[model samples]
Target: MRFLLIVFMGGGLGSIARYLVNKWVGGTLTSVYPYGTFLVNIIGCFLIGFLIFFTQRAGASTIFWRLFLVTGFCGGFTTFSSFTFENVELIGNQQLLLFFVYATGSVVLGLLATYLGILAARNI
Candidate 1:
């Protein structure tokens, strides 16, 4: 029950952060590429990687923190559904090249970002 409350709080904060980022990035960008979701996904992946690495290296043994940050926060921060819907819309609009680029870029870059984050945390 206590763990659930912590996760709930972390999720709420993560959701607000995501919404703000979307408003800031999405509102400013004039492209149909869904930059907001792309950025959020990559950032969330990076954060998860960093947190995992850092916690393990630092010997932080707390399920509450893990659940709060990884399962709750990062889960809420990233939007796979939005990314897929944007891709579908792009394809429907016949923007094949952009769709391909966006889809591939998100996956490749997201993974890279996570790896980089893990490396960074380990090195630090």
Candidate 2:
């Protein structure tokens, strides 16, 4: 239906954007971590937060926009698979403390960001 088409378009563009970020940060410019994924997730989080606030305060966000930006773009941008793989790689490499930090920080921070976004939206 129309909803599916909107999400599909948004997800396709989001994936393309992710590819560009990956290429930009791949191997040459950044090292020691998956900088591209990190950048995308962080940017996506902030954007989701901002959008939530905007959607709440303005009261003008349509279903199509929500499907596109949130269900599609944010969904496509954040990578649970990459996060899990990184954690496993860290653990396999005997970086226990590093793995702990990454895993804990990712979950905790991501949850906190979502909570804060909701709170901001409600208050504003």
Candidate 3:
């Protein structure tokens, strides 16, 4: 029950943060691309990577923290559905080039961000 509560609260917090980020970035960006979702996913990926690395390095058990952060917070923060929808929309609109670029860039950049986070955590 306690674990569930923790996850619930963490998820709420993450969701709120995600919403604010989307509003801010989405409003600021001039491109038609889903920059908000892309940024959120990349940030979530990096954060999860950093959290795992830091916890491991500090000899911390990750069971509860993982559930709260990775399973809950990150789960709420990242939007795979939105990303997929955007890709489909682009494809449906016959923007094949943009669809390919957005999809590929998100995956590639997300991985790179995660790797960088891992490295950053390791160095700390």
lDDT of each: 0.80, 0.77, 0.80
- Tens digits of per-residue lDDT for model 1, 1-124: 8888887887888899899999999779979798887888878867876765666676657676877886678767875634665687799899999999999999999999999999999998
What TM-score would every model get versus the actual structure?
0.59, 0.58, 0.57
Q: List the residue pairs that clash in candidate 1.
A: none
Report how far residue 100 has shifted in candidate 1, in Å: 19
lDDT per residue for candidate 2 within 47-102, as digits (tens), equals 66665456667665476687787667766776553465567679889999999999
Candidate 3: give the clashing pairs. Answer: none
Candidate 3 lDDT over 1-124, as tens digits, reads 9888878877888899899999999789978898987888888877776665676676656678877876678767875634665686799899999999999999999999999999999999
Error of 1 at 71 (Å): 1.8
Q: What clash pairs does model 2 have? A: none
- Candidate 1: residue 80 lDDT (0-100): 61
Superposition error at 64 for model 2 (Å):
1.5
lDDT, candidate 2, at 54: 64
